[model samples]
Target: MSDAVEGGARRRGRDETEEERADRMWQELIQEVRVAQMGVQILFGFLLTVVFTEKYDDLTNTDQTIYLVTVVLGACATGALIGPVSLHRIVSGRRVKPQAVRLASRLTLLGLALLLATTTASLLLILRVATHNGFVPYLVAGVVGWYLLCWLVLPLWTRYRHTSE
Candidate 1:
């Protein structure tokens, strides 16, 4: 085992060299990104089609603004989620897999955060249009809370609790 692998080893099962660890992590990260990417793409596509609808013309100015912002956020999330592929393609065979993986991971996290915001805004817009109820904000807030719990809080908790210090 390399000294670096033995010294600051954080993996659960086996000690691995930095390159090996990076490769494994890259694969795992790509898998996660794939799942997230699919959802975001679908959501973004749906958002794109809304602008052409007759109901879009009847929307209040405020609602239109919200829809525009949501669409922008969805676009950003899509870009961020798809960034890793471009990063990999540009840096292929450069012996920078570790750095690439780290950057890609960061991008994926940012993408997910944006996706959460986009979904919240989309939900709020849809609910407002559908019901015009005062409870739309509350409903969106509840769903956002659920998303935070499932996507961010639980993952961090698991990492903190299970990983060695």
Candidate 2:
């Protein structure tokens, strides 16, 4: 096994060139984005019809506001997740895959954050509507905490523990 060192820093295991690495990263990113994009699009589609539902008028003003905010968040998440595809389409053959990949990765991260917010808001609204209990906020908070642990904390911890920079 050979460990290549560059610029006084240890190189990662992959031996691919920049372009090859970018190509591989782009494919992986797109595959991940496809799954997220589909879910976001479906959630957004459902959100779009919420306002027209007869029960919509029965919601309290607070709940209605939550729904509106959730819809907007979902829309933003959808856009960010889909942005990479458009970015790739416009930048193809431009010899900017590396830069595009970085930008797309940022967009994907932003999309995930937005998705977290959208999901949290939706969960809050649903729980408030379904339970009508005083513990709804606590329940939502607990679930959001679980999501933060599962989606963000664990991944960052694993990366920090297992990888060197």
Candidate 3:
């Protein structure tokens, strides 16, 4: 057990070996991934079914292209979100939980970024189809801004603001 410093202060709950820290981080990351994975899976499933709907054929060429891109992004995001489980299963009993946790965290972050892009693309397609307004892009951008604020900015802000000066 040892103290770890961050921004000049010893981080709380730092009294753990590498393995124990990795185990704790793995548990926490899995819990977080569960929520995100479910959302991505559900969204990807819905996207998969959209092509079979009768209304899909009425989409403009541009809209169809956007839909295609959105669906691909959704699939990629789902893969990244679900990657940690597969990674863990394969790496189990290999004495690599710490490295595994690091890689899984990276995958989760990439998944989140992809999810954000997919959501933005989906909203743009839907709003364009529904309203056909010139302002659709702006509206979609605003929603993306809101998502960024909620998902990343607030957390980063809290982390920065609370850190020792």
RMSD of each: 3.4, 2.3, 3.2
Error of 2 at 109 (Å): 0.5
Q: Tens digit of lDDT per residue, candidate 2, span 26-85?
A: 999999999999889988899999899999999999999999999999999999999999
Model 2 ranges off by over 4 Å: 1-12
Per-residue CA lDDT of model 1 for 70-135, tens digit only, reads 999999999999999999999989999999999999999999999999999999999999999999
Going through the candidates in the order shown, the clash numbers are: 0, 0, 0
Model 2 TM-score (2 dp) = 0.92
Residue 56 CA error for candidate 3 (Å)?
Answer: 0.9
Per the 3 Å backbone cut-off, how many clashing residue pairs does candidate 3 have?
Answer: 0
Q: Estimate each model's TM-score.
A: 0.92, 0.92, 0.91
Per-residue lDDT of model 3, residues 44-126, tens digit only = 89889999999999999999999999999999999999999999999999999999999999999999999999999999999
Whole-model alpha-carbon lDDT for candidate 2: 0.94
Ranking by TM-score: 2, 1, 3
Please state the error at residue 79 of candidate 3 in Å. Answer: 0.5
Candidate 1, residue 49: how far the Cα is off, in Å:
0.5
